[model samples]
Target: MDSLILNILTPVAIFLFIALFTLFAVYAERKIAGFVQDRLGPMETGKYGLLQTFADILKLLQKEFISPSASDKILFALAPILIFVAVFVGYSVIPWGPNLIPSNTHTGLFFIMAVVSIDAIGILMAGWGSNNKYSLLGSIRAIAQMISYELPVGLSLIAAVMITQTLNLNEIAFNQGLLSSKEIYFLGFWKVNEIGGIFGWNIFQAPHLMVSYAIFFIASLAECNRAPFDIPEAESELIGGFHTEYGGIRFAFLFLAEYAMMFLVAMLGVVIFLGAWNSPLPNIGPAKLADWTTGPVWGVFWTLIKSLFIVAVQIWIRWTLPRFRADQLMTLCWKILIPLAFVCMAISGLWRILIMI
Candidate 1:
């Protein structure tokens, strides 16, 4: 219960969760990929290839490390580690479960965006450091795509904060619960707490906010550099995107950053738009599962279940959707998602004013 102990243990727990999740995610991807492509996946490794990810890790670990002759040595080496650190740091700000957050700072949303924005720099550094034209191109694509999408993503996040009137992620989660008592905090100490929470978390707030949440998720996909927005690391063409030259443990770290970022964004989405650690029903919101009735274990259990459902959807999209072409990617972001996000912001403003008046 000491803040210092919490500061230390929480990260260990988060990364451990991420480590286990990554192995499972890899297997899940294989299984989902099989189902999508009409074939069996990971049937031999563990039951239905459940242990497939661990096996992949072993293989990846054993692979040789090869740096390109002309690569930017220092930056290339530092880039992935920097990325992993940035993303992992963001996880500390995520509100995991009720009465069960890491560092519930008022600057949570700010911290989330700040760290995520930095990841673009890492992607670019890795791409350029590889000293390969295709990798450079991939990283460039990643930079452009991620930067473009972040604007709308920021706008949508602004919408949530503006409506909720607090930046503390735990407070936001508390507000979203569909309960009568309305237990919401505005700061580390209660600040001007508003009412009604967010209109059905954040997704259902306004039709436009719903649109913004969609835009945010799509932008997040691009930002995370996942499928449909995966041009930066188009495997068939670029051989591995920014990480083409990386191998062995270095490559592992790159993806460790990738998976960590994936979890960070998913959890951020859950917290920002979906009400971080709050339960769906209001009655359960105030009473944490750690309360006398359910026990702390169930509280932790349900939290992971919710978070994983979001992550699973991300995986589902990856296997189902083909990667986007670079030109199409830019067009979707600059032309489509950005403008759409702006409209959502404007509408959200209008709706809020209308409700007040």
Candidate 2:
């Protein structure tokens, strides 16, 4: 009975967190855009425009749900919910802290990748059900882009997995912390298990993973349909892409899913490469910064801080880089990222063999 109740509340907590995060993320994006473009973003709506996203949410809630006259009503209505659910479900296996994961599946990483791919089907349904040419084109671009990028994303993550030898995300997180059961040496020489800081991170432990992380980051941007790689929703060309026909609450759900995807990918990157929930400070001499800052609560804190920093970088890149032409986007994914990802995977294997020797 207690376990059942906990399971029920876990999803509720995740939903609330996603909702609040979407609100803050939208506001932050607008302000970030304003800063980039040299203009005040939302000064009029409450103090420092803090309430702007809330106001926008209320407006969206009150707006009418409109569908195209000749559209397949069932699929059109179901698309947003399906898309949002696909992204939302990916959070279940995410290890927020040592004890905070909603579901600590052994194949947590595999589960996230599989579930998140379902959104492509939802995107296709949105485009096809609308019976609009632009919508169909946008969905095609999204499918192509996502499928193409998944290669690099998978390969890059495989590099990390090769090093960790576990698909359990919590175990991966543990391996990066001071209390790791396995011994880790810096550059296969200096034992760093006792000194857990940036040194213990996968990127530092296996320097080749820095390349893997880069490939993962670039591919993640495409996965999230973020700017530069946001060909699916190119405002100038597709006029909102696969979601062109959606409005009101349906559109809101799609929007929310996009932001949630952004956060999800960022958090995944943090867990795999940026030390997960472990503190970046190391114990040295008389100072015990890492030991003091390490706990369930601190785990959550460090995880969020690292994840948000990655999100901020995503936002900055969105505003800084111009949108990629469809051809250029595909070329980068197939030719450049895929090759680099393979190299990283090879390096990960070699690194592991050398360490064992």
- The candidate maximizing lDDT is 2
TM-scores of the candidates are 0.87, 0.98
lDDT of 2: 0.92
RMSD of every prediction: 4.8, 0.9
By TM-score, how accurate is candidate 1?
A: 0.87
lDDT of each: 0.74, 0.92
lDDT of 1 by residue, 40-140 (tens): 98788877777777888999888886777799899888888888887888877676666577777988888888987888888888887888888898888
The stretch of ten residues in a row with the least summed lDDT in candidate 2 is 183-192
Q: Record all residue pairs in model 2 with backbone atoms less than 3 Å apart, i.e. clashing.
A: none
Tens-place lDDT digits, model 2, residues 22-69: 999999999999999999999989999999999999999999989989
